[model samples]
Target: MDIRQLKYFVAIVDAGSLSKAAQKLYIAQPSLSQQMAALEDELETQLLLRSARGVKPTTAGHALYQRARAILRQMEQLRADVREDGGSESGMVAVGLPTTIAAVLAVPLFEHVRKHFPGIRLQIFESMSGYISEMLPDGRLDLAILFRDSETHGMSVIPAFDEELYVFGHAGLKLRKTATTCPLSALAGVPLVTPGTVNNLRLLIERTFLREEVELHIVGDIDSLPALMAIAHGGSACTILPASAMLHRAENARPPMRRIVAPDMSRPASVCWSHALPVSAAALAVRKAMVGLIGQLHADGRWPGITLRPPPDAATLEDTSGSV
Candidate 1:
């Protein structure tokens, strides 16, 4: 019925629970419930179905939810765009960040965006690459930093940087220095520690190894990168990492990333956005900032100094002129 009600409804769908959404919105559970009920009542549509586990969007609920997001985004943008004629770029930029990348760059990215584009508010959602990719063309995301760039109908993919994936392991193992650049076959009998089921990166690694017929002795499956690093630090297991992934060493980690590289083993990071919307001035600023920042990071010896993937191929991104 109103933005307030629509927000509550969206939050409920996002959190998948009335109580959780209430908590996130900083409102009482009953109040949030009343708003949603009122909304459904006004629409004369069953927007959601309550369940023991959580709320599920009914067929009608799903449709309204999609419409609600677009409406909200457009309303927000309308206000921002109206204010843009004063020579400042202003709007809400929803950024979709891959988990590990979010952990490493969220703060810095925020700082950069805030410093330059002071009027542009950034909302970051740290999620799996798959989820971000799904959201991009749906008016949910303005941009994303992700790992995979599988072809999407109305989206443009830009291969941003290339970093060497590393093989990480315990201090006690006989890790050879040459393993960093060793063939994927070197991992055939190698024991490793990897992320658990929820981590998409781990899933990708598992599938890649499976396809390559590489049998890795997975020593442990854990969710937290810090914990994985701890086990690796404690000389308890061997794991894989990006040469750019900085793990605090309680002990020396080796063969120090030499074991993870192979022709097909390298994963390129990407920046993507939906081709659905017209590129706003603020989005263009963010895009230029991202390219500059990646290069700057490389020069700082961060992430083993990733090289921007060249253009047009699956290994590259179509370079935008930033002329918009």
Candidate 2:
């Protein structure tokens, strides 16, 4: 019925419960429930079905949720456009990052945006790449930098770079390192602590190993980056990740890392956003800043172990110019 109610409705649906959404929105549960009730009363329809597990959107609620997201996005865009007409890019842009790369890009990206587009607010969501991909269609995220298995789902994909995987563990681990690289066959008996199958990186590693006839020993399945790094740092198991991850780890203390070779494995990283949703000027500015920072990082050898890839189309150049 109102923009505030629509926002509350969308947040509730995304969080899957009134309590959780209330906490996320920093509002009291009773207040959130009252708002939803008022919204339902105004709309003259049942919007949610309550269950022991959580609340789910009813048929009507589901339709409203989708439209509400679009409405909210457009409203935010309108605000940004007004600011842009005043010669300022000022709005919130949600960026999604994979756990592994979050450590690598989070700070630098923030610093870049702050210096270049002080009027724009950047909200970074760190999660598994699969989860980040889900946020695009739901309107929870305006832009995302993540790994791709060649699927865009009608969204625009701007290739950021290609990152080579590596075997990383404690310094005491017996690794056959030659020129800072190790053969994949050497990992037959090596214990690996990796992300769960829900992660795109994990799936890529599995598929590559299967194709190359290498036996990958799975010692742990961790979805948390800190936990995975702790396991590797404690000499429990080696982790297979991109060079940027190792670079992040090495910042605290240099750990043993060797590039995976003998049929090298790498994954493509890209910036993606939903094509169906209109891109706000704020989101576009943030996107360009991100791409430029990544390019600068790769060119300066700051983002180690990744090869910079060209954008799939010329739109990147067009959108980037004068965006910041």
Candidate 3:
């Protein structure tokens, strides 16, 4: 019915109990319940189903919960814009990164915001690319670094870079120390641990292997990057991922890494934001900062195994300016 009621409803849904929501909102439980009742009355529909266990949103409540979150985000962005107009950019900007990319970029991005955009608060979510992809379109994340194959309808996607996949494992693995690359056929019988099929990187690996007529002996499915690396380092199974995934470790301590070749495989990373939502000044600033940081990292060779994609405008200009 109103913004306050919507907020209360969302809190209730998230907390799953009136008492819990009341505690979170710092209001009385009865007051919260009354607000919910008023909201349901105004809408002429039951929003939530109550029970001894807890509460769950009805179908309409689920729908309103999604729209309420987006509306709340917009309202916050409106406030941020007003503050930006007063000469300082200040607001929360949520950015999502896949686990592997987070290993290389998270801290640098956090420090960059702290130094350059003092008033802007950075909320970075590091998870599976699949999860991050789900958040970006619903206003839960202002921006995200997602793979090219991600579901991206109604979103503006900018190519960031292409990173080559590599085979990594402990010294006990069958990999040759003298070789810098491993042929796709070499891994046909190798025990491997990889992210599940839902992950873009995993999907890419699967498609590549299938097309090349190579069979993969996937021993385990690990969505967590750290756990996958640990399994590989312990000689449980070799894992395939970009070199950037190991950037957090000391160079000397890194596991054996060999680029996948004989038809090298790579995945394109893209910066994405919802086209339906109005991006705030703070979000825009963070996006620029992230792009510039990626460029610098690539230029300095700090982030390796990646070829930066040129800006869309540059690509367009080159296309139109080609010699006849």
Top candidate on TM-score is 2
* Tens digit of per-residue lDDT, candidate 2, span 1-324: 788999999999998999999999999999999999999998899999999999998999987876788788778767776867853677788899987778778999999889888888899999888899788766678788878625456576678888888877743345554448888887776788888888888899889889988887887888877777777777768888876675555465545778889988899888887654567667877887788888887778788888888644555544432111
lDDT to native, each model? 0.69, 0.79, 0.82
lDDT of 3 by residue, 180-243 (tens): 8998888887888989989888898889999999987888899988888777777768999999
Say which candidate scores most in lDDT: 3
Please write out the lDDT profile of model 1 over residues 207-288, one tens digit for every residue. Answer: 8888888776786777666676666656666677665445333345423445455544656787787665555667766766
When superposed on Cα atoms, how far off is each prediction in RMSD?
4.2, 3.7, 5.3
Q: How high is the lDDT of residue 76 in model 3?
A: 75
State candidate 1's TM-score: 0.80
lDDT, model 1, position 103 = 57
Model 3's alpha-carbon lDDT is 0.82
Which residue runs of candidate 1 sit more than 4 Å off their true CA positions? Answer: 26-28, 41-45, 84-87, 127-140, 171-174, 177-180, 197-199, 247-256, 262-264, 275-279, 311-324
**Candidate 2: regions farther than 4 A off:** 23-31, 34-49, 58-63, 83-87, 149-151, 170-174, 177-179, 250-253, 311-313, 316-324
